[model samples]
Each structure stands twice: as structure tokens, then as C-alpha cells.
Target: MRALFCYFSATGNTKKCIDLYQNYLSLSGVESDIHNIDDGKLEFNPEDYDMVFFAYPIHGFNAPENVLKFAKTLKKCKEKKRLIILKTSGEHLRINNISSYSLIRILKRRNYYLTNEYHYIMPYDIIFRHTDLMAYNMYEALKGLVPLDVKDILDNKIVKLKYMPFGHLLQIFMLIEHPGAKINGLFMHTNKNCISCGLCEKACPTKNIEIDEKGKVHFKHSCLMCTRCAFYCPKDAIVFGLFNSWKVNGKYSFQMPKEEEVDKHKRYCKNSYNRYFKIAEERIKNQK
Candidate 1:
């Protein structure tokens, strides 16, 4: 079987999950190709593959803007193609499940049916950074869970979420961030700490960031608010406008660090995060 992975990853967590999925699927005898949705380019036809995986990060309780736009551009498939959704979020809130509502609606109209939907918890790109230990654990959980999920797909297991009432309304409401992000992008400014290395400009998926000849970074109104500019900033220079306080910088090493070497977060989202990890652990063990 052949598969296509189309994804939008801001801080790389969702992309990491895609890599894991692709590797595991290959082990199951499936060949796959990848499309980065942020590029606004579709290199392969969905009909050419047996299945298409839509992978992305949950942004503002919804799929990022580029993903939705890309879905609309897909040609209407004559044969119903299977589309699998894999979303990554910082925490495991039920509300996060609604992120796929808009993307799924657009795809279904183009004749792509939802086959399976899976959610994984990754480190935060915004709000607050997860400790290295937590990030490591999340990565490990992702590694363990993806193989099992890939096996289920190979076996034709119809794993999908039940329909939710008023899901459309909720998804529409969450889309406020769509326009809000563009406006918010205008407010992003660099502080003295910025080295004018032009890193943010090159990293911006939307090309919303630019560095002038005089070494000043400017943010455009086209921002998708994926936080790529801020998260990957070498000096943590980009401030997130109104949400500057919530900005999380630096890449996740996903490496095992000694527990004593890392500082622990003070039980923030304690119950929810704990429950998520616990459930993931159980799933991994039971599958074993």
C-alpha cells in the first residue's frame, strides 16, 4: 500500500509525529510520500495514494489556517480516498478534538472520507514550555503508540471519533483566531536581544517575517500564528504581541535528562496532563 502524509507543523512536534508514522508504516510494507501543507503546494494527487494522512498541530483549538486552505484546493476525487488525521497538542483536552472539524468538513466535500483520527500530546510551543523530562516522556509515548496505530490502519481497523453535536458551531467560534492571528502578527516586534541573524525570516512558513537591509525584522499581516517565528528564534527575540507572555521558545531536545537536572513546572494543568499520559501509557501497554 502507498500513503501520502500532508502536514503543517509550526514548532516541529507534529512533523516529528509524521516521521514516526512514516517509519512505522514503511515497516508494515507501506510506501509513503510527504507534503508540507504550509508550502501551499500539492506535489502529488490524493488519488495516487491508497491513503492520505493529514497531520498538524492544534492551534487555538482548531487546525491551522494553511491546512484548511490546502484542503479546499484538493481536486474532487472520483473515488473516495481515505484520509487519516493525526493531530498533536500540548495537552489532552476534549476541546482539542474539535480542531479537525473544519479540515474534515472541507475534505468531505471534495470526496475524501475520514478513515481514522488520532491525537498525540506533544510539548507546548506556546503557553509554557514543558520540562525536558516531560518532553522526553511525550516523545517516548509517541514512539510507542504510533507503531500500534499504524498496525491498526494496516489491518483496516475503522478507528474514528463519534460525531459530536454542534461541532460545527464550536469549530466556527474557534476560528476567530484565523483573522485574529493576522492582526496579532502586526504587533510582533523584536527586542534588543535580537541579533538580526534573519533566522525568523527564513523560518516563517507563511513568509510573514522579513528583515530589512538595516537589520530590523518586520512581521506581516499574513501570519498564521503558528509560532514558528518565535519558537525557533535563536535568541528568543520575537515577542508574540498580546500573547507575548504565553510565548514558548527553544526546540525540544526530546532527550532523557536526569530528573534532578531539570526544573519541574508547578503542577500546571496537572490533572489533565497526568490523565493524558496515563491513558497513553495504558494504551501502549495493552497493545503490547
Candidate 2:
């Protein structure tokens, strides 16, 4: 079967999950093409592929505004097409399950039916960095689960989140992040650490970061709040405005460090994080 992956990955977590899916799906004899949603326009039609995967990182309990806009960009399908959602979040909160509420509603109107949905827990880019150990664990767990999820999709299984009352309404309420993100982007500025390398300008998904002719970095209102400009900044120069204190800079190694005792943020989301890892472990073991 052929598949199309239309994904928005900021900070690489979602893209990393997509990479795992692509590798496993290829092993299962499926050919796939990818379209990074940030790369301008959608050139592929959903009807051309057997199945389409909509993947993104959950932002503020909902899909980012760009994802919603991308959904609108799709041409209405002539036939009932299958679409699967693959989302990644730093925390494993059920509220995040509602992230797809708006996206699915738009796609459904276009005649694309939701077949399966999968969630992956990945390292955080904002609100505080996860411990290296936690990052390693989260990445490893998702790696272990990707194959099983691919197999389920290949088998034509239907997997979806449990029914949540007022899911759509709750997601609508969370839409405040759409504007909040823009305002926050305006607040983003560079400090003395900025060396005018212009990396942030080139990496911003929304083209929100612009380096003026005078070497001044300016942030525009189009920011999707993906935090890619700040998180992946080589010099850690981009201050994330009001959320600067919570900004997590640097890419995760996703490697098990030899001395692994760094658990400074262990109490941040202890119970929920532990429960997610434990459940993921059980599920992986069962799948084996």
C-alpha cells in the first residue's frame, strides 16, 4: 500500500516518530512519500494515496494552528479516503487526545475518514526540559511501540481515543493558544549570546524569525509557537519571551548516558509520567 505523511514537526520529536514509522512501514513492504507541512503547499492529493498520515506535535492541548490551516488546504476528496493521525506530546495527558478534534472535523468534511490514531510521548521543548534519563526513556518507548502501531494500521484495525464528553468544545476553548502563541512570538528576542548567525531565521517553521540588515533578530506575529527556533538554536540565543525561563534548549541525545542519575525534574509530573511509561512498557511487552 502507498501512504502519504503530512507532518509538522518542531524540535524534531514528531519527525523522529515519523522516521520510525517510515522505517517500519518500509520493512512491511509499504511505500510512502512525505510532505513537511511547513514546506509551503500541499502538492499531493489524498485520493492518490491508499492512506494518509497526519502527524504533528500537540500544542496547548490541541493541534497547532498551522496544522488546522493545512487541513483546510486539502482538496475535498472525491472518495472516502483513510487518514491516520500520529501525534506526539511531552506529557501523556488524556486531554491531549483531544488535540485532533479540530483537525479531524475538517478532514471528515472533506470525505477523509479517521481510521487509526496513535500518540507518542516525546521530550519537551518548552515548559522545562526533561531529564536526560526521562528523554531517553520516552524516545525508547515510542521506538518500541511504532512497529506495533504500523502493523495494526497495515491490518486495517481501527484505533481511536476513548469518547470524551465535550471534546470539541474543550478544544475550542483551548484555541486561545492560537493568538497567545503569536503574542508570545513577538516577545521573543535575542540576547548578547546571539552571534547573528541567522540560524533561527532559517529554521523557524512560520518564517517568524527574521534577521534585519543590521543584524537585529525580529520575531513576527505568525509564530506557531513550535519553539523550534529557540530549542534548536546553536547558541541558545533566542529568548522565548515570557516563557524564557521554561525554554528547553538543545536537542536530546536520546541515548542512555553511562552515569544516568539526572532526575532533577522528577517531581514535575511524577505520577502521570510514571503511569505512562509503565503502561507503555506493559503494552510493548504484550505486543512482543
Clashes of each: 0, 0
- For model 2, the superposed segments whose C-alpha errors exceed 4 Å read none
Full-model lDDT, candidate 2: 0.90
For residues 207-273, could you state the per-residue lDDT of candidate 2 as single tens digits? Answer: 8878989999999889888889888888999889878898989999988877857677778778888
Residue 46 accuracy (lDDT) in model 1: 85
lDDT of 1 by residue, 1-288 (tens): 899999989989999999999999988789999999867779898889989999999999899888898888899999999989999999887878788999998999998888899999999998888888889989999998999889889988989865667877998999999999998888899999999998889888888888999999988889998899899889988889988998998898999986555455757788988898888899899987
lDDT of each: 0.89, 0.90
Candidate with maximal TM-score: 2
Query: Number of the top candidate by lDDT?
Result: 2
